[model samples]
Target: MKPGQQDNMREDIYQEIQKQKAMSREKEAVGKLAGRIMHDFNNVIGAIEGYAALISSETADPVVREDAEQIRAICAKASRLTKELRNIAAPWEPESESRSSETTAVLSDKKVSCKILLVEDEDSLRKASTRILSKVGYQVFEAENAEQAFEIFKKENPDILFTDIVMPGKSGTELARELKDSKPRLKVLFTSGYVNEKGKIEEINSNTGLFIHKPYDYEALMKMIGGLCAEAQA
Candidate 1:
């Protein structure tokens, strides 16, 4: 090859590499922003689902109940959109056959006395979850973040640590690890809209820790907690 031609080819390859790196950085930034937005949006949806449940249960009026149900249906649709957003942010591989089957299995209604330490930064969602769990006869303690959660954990020594994955100071996984170090028997259930930290969810699942995605309804929440409580008993 001619010297000029070779030089031009080298420059072209370098430019292509730089361009690829720039695109990668841009994608990473977008993913981070999307993660934050998904978390906030899911929190809103969760709050809506909670309030809708409250309205449906408390109101005797059939029309009001129907309206509440409609709201819940809307929330479900929104939840699916958020799930898509999560995929765009971080394309998660499909769960394995065994895990998929386990998730699909019908959870039994066996009652077991259990205490849950619910930790989430979002206030409305946390309050709604607390109300829903408490209404279902499970004792629930609430905290806004992991630091407060640890304090409650020390005091309550609850059966289940139901917490969000992302938070301001300490992430839920860190809290779970710290608490579990002290009390290995404490069952940990992690919830999140989108996992910002890669493989953390898989790590938790691998360790037999429980997880429920955000914007989950009362029934889903109850089933997860119930399963955890049953596991604790077993």
Candidate 2:
């Protein structure tokens, strides 16, 4: 191999390696973004499913029930699609409940009246989830970030804290920990889009069932709320 020819080949190889590295970085960035997006998507789905469930429960008309059922079916399909997208971006272990398409019936004929402090950095999702939660008979307080959530938590002293795990500042887990120290009985529902390396949702304490994945259905949310509230009040 001539010196000049060998030098040129080496340069070509270096450039190719750099190019591959750039592509890999880009993929990683996109995957993280997709995971975040999937989380927000779940919030939207939760709102949609919640509203539909409210309608289904309120209306006596068969046609209205049918319409609500159709809406739920579409939301269920969307939830599945987002799951696939999130998996492509960052594959993680899913809970058995997360895989199921079946929606549970409302826990009781009467809506459980409770106060919720909803903390989410995503504005669209924050508004959507709050609206649906309020529509379904819960008093909901909104916060844009952990700081705001802290302020709201101080003032409202809500029964439950429904917060996104990843937030702008002082993550949901941090907020939950601080608040729980002050109010040990405060029921918390921690939600997240991305899973840790271990393929498990991070639990703040022994309350294993307190964690909920994104794009959750209305029934599941309600069930969680009811159970948490009951525990808190107990």
Candidate 3:
């Protein structure tokens, strides 16, 4: 090739490489923003759903119960939209067959007798999950972040650790690892709305830990907890 032609070809390649790098950086920024937004949005949905559940259960009036049910239905729809946003932010393949089975296991009316340590940075989401679990006869202890969670874990020695993956200081996976070092058989169930932590999530699943996406309904959450409790007993 002519020297002039060679020089132009090299410049074109370098520009293309720079363009790709810029696109990658932009994608990362968008994903981080989406993760933050989804985390907050899911917490709101969880709070609304929890309140609706309370209304449905406490009210004897059929009309009130119907309204509460409608609210839950709307939350479910909103949850799906958040899930779509997650996909757009960081697309990934669907859950493995084993993981799918764990989440969709057949639920039972049988009361679970187990202590649960629920850790989440989001206050509303943590409280909602705690209330929902407590209502169903599970002994739930909640903490706003991993620091408090560690204290609770030391005292409670909970049967299962239900935590959000990405917290402010210590991530849920980090807490779980530290706790598991002391108690190897400790069952863990991680939750998150941020798809950016897909790597951490996959690592958790591969290590025999459980995970449920954020904005999950009461039934789905129960299914995961029930399955973990059963495994704990076994």
Best by lDDT: 1
Compose the digit string of candidate 3's lDDT tens values, residues 1-234: 999999999999999999999999999998889888987898888788777776776678999988887888788788778777877887772341121112112222346789999998778777877877887788999899889988898898899999888788998888888889888889988777764755785668665677777776666678778888988999
Looking at candidate 2, what is the lDDT of residue 186?
85
lDDT ranking, high to low: 1, 3, 2
Which regions in candidate 1 have their CA more than 4 angstroms from the true location? 93-112
Q: Which ten residues in a row have the lowest lDDT in candidate 1?
A: 96-105
State TM-scores per candidate: 0.89, 0.74, 0.88
Return the lDDT, model 1, position 219: 72
Off by over 4 Å in 2: 1-17, 93-96, 99-104, 107-115, 121-140, 193-209
Cα error, residue 82 of model 2, in Å, equals: 0.7
Model 2 pairs in collision:
42-215
**What's the number of clashes in each of the models?**
0, 1, 0
Task: State the lDDT of candidate 2 residue by residue for 1-234, as single tens digits.
Answer: 999999999999999999999999999888878876776677677667766766676678989988987888898898778777877886653452443333424523455578899988767667767766676578899997889888888899998999887777787878888888888888889877655434235445543437777766656776788788788777
- List the candidate numbers ranked by TM-score, top first: 1, 3, 2
Please give, for residues 42-128, the per-residue lDDT of candidate 1 as tens digits: 899989878887777767899998888788888888887877778788887222111111111222333447999999999999998
